[model samples]
Target: MNYETFENRVLPVKNKLFRFAFRLLGSSEEAKDVVQEVMIKVWNGREQMATIENMEAWCMRITKNLSLDRLRSNQRRATDSLTEGFEIRQETLTPHERTEIHENMQRVNEMIAALPEKQRQVIHLRDVEGYSYNEICEILELDMNQVKVNLFRARTTVREKLVKINAYGL
Candidate 1:
């Protein structure tokens, strides 16, 4: 692909790709690095890319693999930070509101982190990244049924956890 065409076509997806990487890796800097690496790889393989049926799926697959490799190499559990990009303003909030928001966010993050790897990946692609089932299957190299099952399990697990947390006032 020509540089202009590649930029016009693929560049728009960078933010989405970066967000996917960030959600998976839980580090903004690492996510940015993954996006750069994935883009470079795509650029290098542009000739072969022409033969690929789904460029978005292909790019997502590359991003997921690279992010997983980075995670494995680091040997660290994923930890999401609300303070990923913009610094939290110290503007005072009512104590009640602050506590409620903090608790809810923490609960959500913990539930997501607690999900199984395949389930978490499916959730990230389907929910967070807004990918269709077919695209998610392509990115994850899983069959359609597997993708559906994992996504169902992931959402169900998260919903159950949230219900329990609410019932117990956690």
Candidate 2:
């Protein structure tokens, strides 16, 4: 791709890339670095880009791999804080409602964080990023059945935990 085409197509996905990196690495600074690396890598490999379709998915795959590499090297678990990307409209809700929403979101985030790595990744790419199943499969390098199964298990686990919490007022 030419510079102009790269700027138009690749630059726009930086936020998505950063978000995915953050989801995996659980650190904003590290996520930014990973995104920068991805940009540089993509630019350097521009010749190979012509043959590939779905630039965004390809970028996400790179982000995932780099983030996983960092994680493996660091030997630390991801402490994903979903509120970083989540926004609650302050103007519409009272302070109490806002607090309640924040707490609920935090609870859900904890539930998601407790999931297995693959399940967490599948859930984030599919539900949070709104990627289609095929795109998620491409980004995650999983088959359609594996992606569907992981998503189903993640959602079901979260739902059951929420139900239990509600029923028990826990």
Candidate 3:
């Protein structure tokens, strides 16, 4: 793929890739590094990338592998803090709405953080990143049935937790 084509088609997905990496690595700096590495690899492999059936999936697969590698390498460092440097965008919401959304997002993020790695990945790809099942299966290298099962389980778990929290007025 040409640089122009890559910029037009692939660069738009960078934020999603970075968010996925951030969620997995829990560090903005590491996530940024991962995204740069992923993009560099993609640019170097652009000739072969055109032959790939699904570019987004292929890119995500690369991102996931690289992020995992970074995570493993960084395990020897200080433990990851629960509070990463990620900030919620505040441009659009009114003060009251922003506070409410922030509170809800915090709770949801906590719930997601408690999920198993596979489930959290699936839910994030599907719900947060808006990836289709086929694309997620491709990125994760899982069968269709397995993707469906994991997504269903993850959604169910989140729903149940939310229900219980509401019931308890938490």
Tell me how many clashing residue pairs each candidate has.
Answer: 0, 0, 0
Per-residue CA lDDT of model 2 for 29-129, tens digit only, reads 89999999999999999999988999999999999999999999999888757676568867789889988999988988788888889999999998889
Candidate 3 lDDT, tens digit per residue, 1-170? 79999999888889989988877877778888999999999999988985798888888899899988887776632224545553668687788887777678778888887777778789999998899888999999999999999999999999999999899968
Stretches off by above 4 angstroms in model 3 are: 76-97
lDDT of 2: 0.91
* Candidate 1, 1-170: lDDT as tens digits: 99998899888889888987887888888999999999999999999987999898899889999999999999887766644344224558777777667767766877887787889889988888788888898999999999999999999999888788779976
Sorted by lDDT (best first), the order is 2, 1, 3
Provide the TM-score for each candidate, comma-separated. 0.87, 0.93, 0.85
lDDT of 1 at 161: 81
Best by TM-score: 2
- The order of the candidates by TM-score, greatest first, is 2, 1, 3
Provide the RMSD of all predictions against the true structure, rounded to 1 decimal.
Answer: 2.8, 1.5, 3.1
Q: Which regions in candidate 2 have their CA more than 4 angstroms from the true location?
A: 80-86
